[model samples]
Target chain A: MRPDFGLLLINLGINNTVYVKTDPREIALLEGLAKDDRQAIETIYKQHYNMVQTLIINNNGSADDARDVFQEAMIVLYEKARSGTFELNCLLKTYIYSVCRRLWLKRLQQQQKFVSDIENVSETVPVEDELEAHGQRNTEFQMMEKAMQHIGEPCRSLLEAFYIQKRNMLDIAGHFGYTNADNAKNQKYKCLMRLKKLFFAAYKNNTP
Target chain B: MEEMQLLDAVERYLNNEMPADEKAFFEQLRKTNPEVDQLVVEHSMFLQQMDRFSDWKQYKATLHDVHSELLETGSIQEKAPRATVVQLWKKYQRVVAVAASIAGITALTISAIAYYFAPKPASEIQLLSRELANIKRTQTITDKKINALTGQASTRFIPPADPKSGGTGFLIDGKGYLVTSAHIVANADSVYIQNTKGDYFKVSTLYVNKQTDIAVLKIVDNRYQPIKNLPYALQKNLADLGEDVFTMGFPRTSTEIVYNKGYLSAKTGYNGDTTTYQLAISANPGNSGGPIFNHSGEVIGILSGKQTTAEGVVFSSRTRNIFTALHEIRKDSTNEDRIKLLLPSSIKGLDRIQQIKKIEDCMFMVIRY
Candidate 1:
């Protein structure tokens, strides 16, 4: 009775328009399953299994593992919902991703005990917090790269030679077809100024 | 000429290609142009950091792409007919349904038997209600206390006021009034409140606001005393347009409290009913009933609701209304008196009473044990 009331209330409350609505199709399927409708559960698994797999694989997990974790996470969600314990706080996608992320992290942590050289895969990446962080990092990195690209060919060459290749002034002078080391160094200073200008401009554009 | 000469020397020095005499000259250049030198150093470090950042970014993107492709292929290979799970679930449907119906009937029968045979205990019921009110007060106070101690202004993935199941609450009073969203404590049989200092105590009383979906609980045991001389009024008036407001709550049920910075977008009455006010602040479930603060760090409102309708659109209750509710509830015992206090004097007549009755019907008491 407790479980039934819980499930019924959640299902009813969820149906209320005030509770940010999920996909009608999915909700219908979920409802049908709650009412013991078998076809609805099958349709949900068929449609969402790939999406779940994609999320897992994107976060440093293998396809096979993604499938296993996705299935298990779905089963856990299903059980929780069936028992009327699952509260629909977020969109179904967000909830599923969270569950999948947790399962994947657990799997990784277990694997880490056996494998020492596994890279520091961020276990928390599947959550919205990590997603936002990852997005910001990507934007900043892209802005920086674009600025570097916009610095013109001469400045680009100068920066790459001086910073990346660690080439001496004389070698850079020869490479850039300059008159002497002093001229090469002056050109490098001008190029650095141009690069800085481009970088700041791009940073400003991207940030605000 | 001086600027040109200085630039030449700086360039040579940075390239490490300057002759000893020129290097000495460059050393003097550093003193005269310290700002420029500092800028150069910082810029160089920035470039180095960006280099590492780019490398990792590319690596991560490539990994993501590979992962997605692999997952796609795996799904294709493992794709089962859509009807399979549904069929299996449907097959077991009748058995579970019948069992559930029997359980429901039995529960109804037991309740009927108890009502007829065992008279209600009056003192115990009064104690239960009082205890519930005390618990709610404690929960609100505990959440506020935790927010103050952590200096975390925003609410996101804060650990719960109760640490065991990872729910978040705010301390509203030194007397252990903890306020959290009802959803956090909905299923809790026993609740515990923990502070940033890691002190925890068992909480027994719980008061829930089902309409607003807010819950307040209080800790009974005094493992820790409330901070002396703290302000406990509702947050300041609802935020103005674009005014930065902060929410403190547990977003992901994590150990650390999450703080989210957002601005008030729009204000309307609850569900657009106009009887109550709602403020748009970025909040999640665990944030329910936690304090919303302005930049001055004063409570501007309490987070009451959030809607994930379109991306980035969230709703919160205005502090003024929540304050009114709390004030009326604290001051009055009878529903009539509470409604009289809550509504304006002009709206306290017979017709008004009927309307108040409707509102009361919509309001359900949330009980958390």
Candidate 2:
């Protein structure tokens, strides 16, 4: 008897996707853009550009302005991905919206316009204040960046390979001469700790 | 199965690495054990964090390369022979002098125009008149009966005998380290905390944000009973537009915590400041410093401010700030944990709620009054 292809496809699809409802393939495509893949970037842009455009338009920006802001946001994402600094802490859509939102808000303020467009917007998360506070701590980001630079070569390389190179666990393991993927992961964790130690040391010294 | 093994299997399953037999076992486990199911969800979040970190590194590398290239090109030109520089300098001198004269003339004309068009400085009497008119307008608007009613209700929330009106805060560590608006608690006779169970404890020794409006308060009594199995919300990075979020705090009435639900309106940048993203949400005066949660009840931001005129334009300090603040308070904490906690919150559908509830259950709760 033949196996049910429909069931197989569903099962395969569910297993590969992070969230059951969202298209996992889209996420993969977005993830691939980290490798400087223009095709993947274009795919992501086509899929979610409307949402980003809407975000800007809703936030008191014109369509033309939205287009410019969206492009700028994409460029920033592209740069971050190329530099290995773009962390996928949120969904691609969310991250894109955030980038656009920040850009649009900045544009409005630079134009010296009252931010009445955002007047009715309701925030569910308290991210705004947090981002502001983080912005104010210029010393912390600078210190953290400096510490990251000072970390030992092996640790830095492992971190860069795993994070910046967008290498899979198995690939990272092979590149780093680890016994297996698990070992590579564990090594990454350890290296992360070392980075944190350096960061703390720098932060502490800078503090009065 | 043991928790570690269970977590590992869940991680494998999330990564699509589970063999048929293990996948079957995991699916079975999910049905029988909600705790294990929750563990899987939490572990998946860690995976998401890893993915994000990886992507961030990739982007950072690209930026670094661009900067290096720019520097190299600039340096090469700077190092060119002196002979070429002298020839170019001579050739450009006449053009440069003409251009400078034209620029100078344009600047003078623009400055003169600006001076001619500029409004005269207002006299003291004029300034006073304007101030009085603004005050009258404010009074007229606030005189509405609804405004009076709301004002009275707000006043009622504050105890007459107690000098300090309650503010917002969060629990750091197992200790009752709470943060709130400095303006709220700057003048207080006493500070107290009320847990989810309605138990109250006194607090003392507070820390304030360096420049912003946040203040931190530590529980005074060493023996004070901290809330057990508290639901500590993970402070994720931030919320995206259309992501569902909920805020819990005392609004006008201090008798009970008010829960308001809304989507992230906008990721805002204040006054051309590109460094931070501000969120517009629905918040009130009493909600300052209250935890803002995603639909899964993960604390994404701290409700800090609301638009002075409007009802929905609430502002928050990002979870990143809290992480940095916590780092400053305790240097021993790992950045991994901080990064994990500060990972941004995103919208997930209702089908994912079961997965999210498990994570929410692990959150530690801090109650303050």
Candidate 3:
């Protein structure tokens, strides 16, 4: 959850919050991401959300644009950290800022808007592999999300319960009202195969 | 049939359920079959996307709570303008009223949908079982048709039902004798065994026990040396459930020797077969004939197929059965001196890594041409 600033949401849009330096505590906090702790990431977002907002808003973007880019950058970091592919070469805040700046630049370029502060973004050289991995992940996530919408129910929920919630076969059986875990197991396989089919088909159509 | 096995293997590999050797084989497949590779990526992404969606909802809920607290405490550094507050309230009220009415309808619709789906959970198992049977029948018919047209090359394409399984095997005695799964070389006219050194030797199947599905082969190449006093021996006793064990195999057709360790998870094989014990290792098809060894390097069982119904459940034929089969093979007077009757393992009590190091040379791959 975002920390409440009371009526001070106005200050969130302001550019004066001093950037935080990476500390030992922050290292521990980033490590929490690898452990799949959401609270750590949310705290990271809470701290850096304002910096991202100021960057985007100052550079010909909207508050919504800042929010989206900031969120995407956080996801990028989250995935990298979780995969153990990231190294703390620089401060965590610096790393996230670079990602947001790069994303903002990409957006500006997509709309054919000239980016004035492109030099500032180029300073950190945001981890290339991380950026690419995150890009691929985002693309996959979006495609899969779209495919999920087209899928029929029960199968959808079954996938969510098993894959998303990481529930066991028996528990899933009980929740989904199957006769037995084995029965649910077979049904789950069919659902997964079908989901893969539908997802791949949609991905193909969408890609080119 | 080969295509089906490939798909199954790909699925398991994508799930990270394959042991090291089998995983290497799957990596090779990804290099060769771009379609399979793409399928893996798509399936993984699909699963990940679902997880991301779940997390997103949780995250948004937390964010909403934070937003409410900020509003309640008015701790925001600067108050939002009075005019902006009024305008926001006006906009919010409209949204809230619309959202309230939609949510009411949505709740009713959800309950109706839930009720419709709740009662009917029938025939899924029966349907899948039948579907599997149908696939088997179709595969057999296709194989028979291909057999009929073997002499003449035709436009029709028929895949082999029993696909090539590059399974594992280990030398039981130091005299070029090896034990592998019967199914690995079953119904095959020509079979070759290879080792980690890339040396391919002719495998003469001396005994094929179909009931227990264990095969004993003698490596016949004169150039191949009978490995000296072996460092490992087959266990005369059964492996207790939850005993620490490890195995090695040429899972990727001898690309690299691979080792995996897990505990014996069950006293009997799938469906409670007494001749085999179920291990918790993620053994794959290519690891079918690998040896399951105790921490002291005693060969306890033969590494076999994984149960498709669950993850991390592997079944291995008992070493005792392999010994029993060897005993039966040695009973003939003419064969008495030809094949060694009793092959006992001499190595024991070594650490895990050292045991693996010594036992790796005894491992072989049963490859079908």
Candidate 4:
């Protein structure tokens, strides 16, 4: 049986009266999404992906375009859910439709495919702040990725084994052929320093 | 060393692993020293960034897997643009006919105009792999005709079955895990991999990422014996430009392994695709999914395709993609097998001939049906 989110819903209700009318099912799904649960993602995709795809296809976009925009909007929703501060004041459908619309509009303007305003019967909420936060996080994630790529071999693998994989130093030592946990820890420290320098360098360049 | 110690202490304190007294002492030090306080704040932010970065990657990978799985299961469908184009063509059929007749009268000029306005980029590169299935189909047709005439069954070592596509694959893990080009086996009904010794083993697809053109397969045949270790290490770093690189593949009708030597010509593939490397190597239809080995015998890339417009210009997906693919595969809870990648380069300092001898044992012909 799925774990009950009744306690969570009650706590959220008492903490914020704004979410009193929000569906507990939506909250549970978002919580699952925050945890990166596969079933939850699949459920969301099955429910909302078609609606978003139809919206994009009707607005002078191909099926591939629909898939891309929908996935990016999903990422935006994921970022919001993972932040743990999102308060659902509207239906999940309306919010997703809003986010996908805003994203598709920006994409259209970029591609010079802007013909006219997209037609939508659904209600939309303001999501500028959410999109901005998502954009900033996306940039930082990319910078970190570039740094990881640049930091060559053993160093890259060592830090990843520790931080990303969450492997203990002793287990990592045996896996990477290091002599002892202290040796692995020392190597990890060096790698971490290099990664930080590269990451901050890219971060500074992007911001400035 | 001193900085390492400080960072370790900060990490312990941040993680709340420090004893109460030690934590209190550290808090007092942070209050007294502005630099220590700054260090704690900076380290905390950096660690948080790392954590979020890891989460973002995992989430993106899961999204990709989910998208592909849904596509396969037909939960979501991709609309083809061809249907609309065909309808438009039908509506303009008369106008097109008139234009075609007029163009035929001025064929030379029309040819020049068409060449000038052609979509150039679309035809620049070609996937140089897989046509053995067609050959097998034709052979089967002939064999059936002979059987109908002779009234006796043809005695062949291998059964007559339809192999959908074929390409080269190599063992990434000695315990029968193989990596090949995704396109070669994307829609295959049943996949089989054959060693150079003509021993065929059944395999199952474990993971596939079409964007990277990488697919991982695990041998499920009981007859196969696992090797102790792999000879070549998959290179994590990009191979240097102009480095001597050689590849072994089955690029011929026969089962014999073929070898070709070339140099790394560019850091990127055709159209500046960063995920792949361009090489000055001669590759043919059956060369896809072959491993491109550097001088030290580290597998740097997997030969994917070649530029059709340029002679001797081939491209191979970077080796690091395999690492990323394996990492994503390991994250799936349903998969119990832990795929460990061999890191040490045992073939280092070996001659070209000896290196090929050892590498050939790990190479297999991917048979898709």
Candidate 5:
């Protein structure tokens, strides 16, 4: 049997989920991405890969370049969702394109690889703060990555299930094969404590 | 503030469960107290980091699918061309050149696959008997050890050890006596015991029993001592075949302790060897000599080795084997101080997770060079 790649975990308590329109669907996609849902992410890739590809290719890049930009944008979106701070202020598709645009432009500038065409386009000029904030976010996110890889499970998995996946207390309890639900909660706290110790210790010690 | 309370407050603050007044108070504290401020930032970063990890895992999976899809179906029909066709025509030449190169790369890839599949001799296949659990994977963790101003605190990505050899061991006493599989240290020129906290201590072999395959070691440094009370009692009731059993060990050299669960699947060892029990737990290469604990946190067996062809059927030397060896060493008048260190565990009635917490600190990864 094929594994179901996504679990549609909606924190939206009210409003029955019958309407599979844009917002709820995006929320589901974001949540699915948080859950690391394969199909949801593939749908996203299929939807946006070409958009990013066309932009990069038109601006003197290749299909491979497009793939990288799209993947990178997906990572940024995934980071936003994983942070549990994602609110559907804009459509997911629109946000992805803008992010890809920013990323591609930044890369092109860094490498000084491309010429014009992306410049005169009336897309919202990304501000200094926005660029700086994105840079800061990327650096901090990278630091977090280093510290987390050093952490082993079930501490690692517990934290992921809670903060990233937003899985409820009981389901996490079952997943880790804990003796009971209460133990799972306590263990989650313990794991969090350990994570804080690991993360901050590495944070203070990390020069970058 | 107290450390535990500080941790508790950090949790409450992050979970947003603090009362309105408390939230205001904590925010005030965050301004005045640097520790609380650091804690708050660290907590948020931890959440983001954990989420990033989850995303990367799923993201990698989708990326893999896309790579395959692109390879097979050739770019999924280009998504209806949002850009103007005139601009696209102007851009198509450069893209065409890139596409030609990509096609050349694909041809090279197909040839590479053909070369990779070219088969050779049956003599290349030999059943490997040496069950060494060295960290085999190429480690991406660049920094070997994390150094604080005060001391060495973090050892990242299982520091460099002989890629050929490694094994597991557990602290039998607070004064630094450890019990591991004989095969781990029996052939080692130099041995280092790395704790879960990433502290490495040199260890000298105190004893190694060849037949039973149990070895003991004493930590070289005098300052280091583990938990005073051994986390598990040495309870050797091997009567029941189906008992809750678990092991904590470094199954691979590069990672920290891994915990696996299963039942005592059989009475005899491999090929009906009497000194061991057939545990249903999947004992990997590096798990040799790890303490096998029952649900009550009793040391029922010392995990030895697993058969090559079987899955989840590993052998663990019964606690009785260790006891018999200890008795013989006493009779032969081995150093009196050597026997003094081994102690019965004081912990009991703890469930699985609790047992793990207590026992995890007591286990160490033996990095042999």
Candidate 6:
């Protein structure tokens, strides 16, 4: 029975020549990644970080540079997977390698350093569309970050406590020294409006 | 004020915190007023951005944490040091070669002088036997001298000047069986345990397992009284990481039992040994065989040793090893008495002071001669 099942698997592998099938393990990891699971992200980072680190370090990049490029690629993959449009045309390893390569290449060119042919250590996948979407998302995220920086004082901390830390109003009230939750909630609303205005200003400036 | 109220309502509606009737009314208002509908749409988009922004920040934090952890564990390598180290080695080659020869000549000269002055033995086998006999004879003479000085008939005993080794141990069975580190009592002519009150009792080694570094002792002296119950139970299960733990031991320098508290840092010991746990507590020499207790007052592990080069990198033999050792002890039917482990610790709910008061009596200073 085991040999018969093995033969069936071989036939199935032979028949599925046109389309590259995704590994069930990779699918499970990507699904976990979408939910921002720390273990899944850690596993992926442990598995693929060395490959990306080696690629970058071999091409006139330092370990810190390798870390930055790899992390940016991770963000791209994370956002794409979370957006629910990531289709596995290639293995996750190959895709991450390609993304890291493209990201490092762009970084090197931007710095106007002397360029040479980068060694392709793995199979390549065309992730230009995915990268473009990530770029737009990154711009918006940066705008939000800038707005948060300029939001200032207790307001910034207040908004962070509510939105980022996801603390409830009562806890925020006690932590921020508000007499009641209603006062904290009101302060949070005012802070949110100011943050929205600042974010939009950066958004409009970037578009034009 | 009016705009704040509207914004609050819109946020509540977006978060699905609105009541059924109020939500229905809000939906009708959205249909009738294009301005309110636009506000709802805009707020929803902003809320989505906020959600993603939080996630992005959190994911970045996780990546940073994982990177640092992996680096600490040596799972990943940094590239900058390697290139720089190679260049530095090349530049210092001549200087290193010159220093190496000078050091080598100095070491050889020192060894030559030492070898010239060293005593020669008649034969290797005879010398080994003679040295062993000499050590035993000297130890016996010292023991006799100390006993004469202290007067052996007294209930209180003074510690000898030179002991073979010393460590802490605790009672495992109320029937006078105590557990201690095997290294403490592994090779000894006599073993004695002194309580905090300075009362001493002679004990004989019952079983010693060098593999787990655990030894069992039974008090044979008539001066010892068997307690009816032990306050703390030996924990059978593995303890969780980051649980608060405290230990009491007689560090060699201190006469009194020193109490120290720390937490379990890792589930495994040095080099991932499953039978031990890595703790973040600082331990000194003579702290071996001390009981590591959790906050709830159960004996979780036996304090074993510490990494010499690092601070607070202590390792403890897990309490379950005692169980495994006892299983082996039970299999040997020649052992007449049964070693019953204490269960249902009485000190479970007590505060630290009360718990220590009840437990301090069971802790003993093991001195080997």
- Chain A accuracy as TM-score for every candidate: 0.40, 0.43, 0.75, 0.82, 0.53, 0.86
Tens-place lDDT digits, model 2, residues A32-128: 6666665565565555566655665545465567556766566555544544544454566756666667667767889998685453232222135
TM-score of each: 0.28, 0.30, 0.37, 0.47, 0.37, 0.47
**Best-to-worst DockQ order:** 6, 4, 5, 3, 2, 1
The candidates' DockQ values read 0.03, 0.04, 0.08, 0.31, 0.13, 0.32
Decoy 1 TM-score against native: 0.28
Write candidate 6's Cα lDDT for B94-203 as tens digits. Answer: 99999999999999999999999777656767989989999999999999998997786566656565788899999999789999998999889999998898777889
Compared with the true structure, all predictions reach lDDT values of 0.57, 0.59, 0.74, 0.87, 0.73, 0.88
Model 4 regions lying over 4 Å from their true place: A1-20, B81-369
Candidate with more favorable, higher DockQ: 4 or 6: 6
For residue A128, give model 4's deviation from the true position in Å: 1.9
Tell me, what's the RMSD of every candidate? 40.6, 44.6, 43.3, 39.9, 40.0, 33.9
Relative to the real complex, the DockQ score for model 1 comes to: 0.03
Model 4 docking tier (incorrect/acceptable/medium/high): acceptable
Error of 3 at B225 (Å): 99
Best by lDDT: 6
Share of reference contacts found in each model = 0.06, 0.09, 0.15, 0.55, 0.30, 0.55
Model 6 bad stretches (over 4 Å): A1-19, A114-116, B81-369
- Chain A (candidate 2) TM-score to true chain A: 0.43
The TM-score obtained by model 6 is 0.47
lDDT of 2 by residue, B1-369 (tens): 254455556667987988899789889989899888877775565445445455544544553453345346552111222355665788799999999999999999999999998867667679889999999998888789778788776522221333346555655444456656666666566666654444455666345564455565676655465444334456455567777777666655343555576766667534522223355566666777776677665666767676666655666666566666665655544422221232333333443445344333222223333
Question: How good is the docking of model 2, as DockQ?
Answer: 0.04
lDDT of 6 by residue, A48-146 (tens): 899898898777788999999999998988887897845677788988998999988888999998588687766677778888888898889999998
Q: Which tens-of-lDDT digit does each residue in B143-216 have in candidate 5?
A: 33322422553333233544458889887667787889898897788788888887778888877887888887
Candidate scoring better on lDDT of 2 and 3: 3
Better of 1 and 4 by TM-score: 4
lDDT, candidate 4, B73-176, per-residue tens:
99987765445677579879999999998888899888899999987864544321235666788999999998796675333236346676789999999998
Isolated chain B TM-score per model: 0.41, 0.44, 0.54, 0.57, 0.55, 0.58
Count residue pairs with overlapping backbones in model 5. 1
Q: Calculate model 5's interface RMSD in Å.
A: 6.5
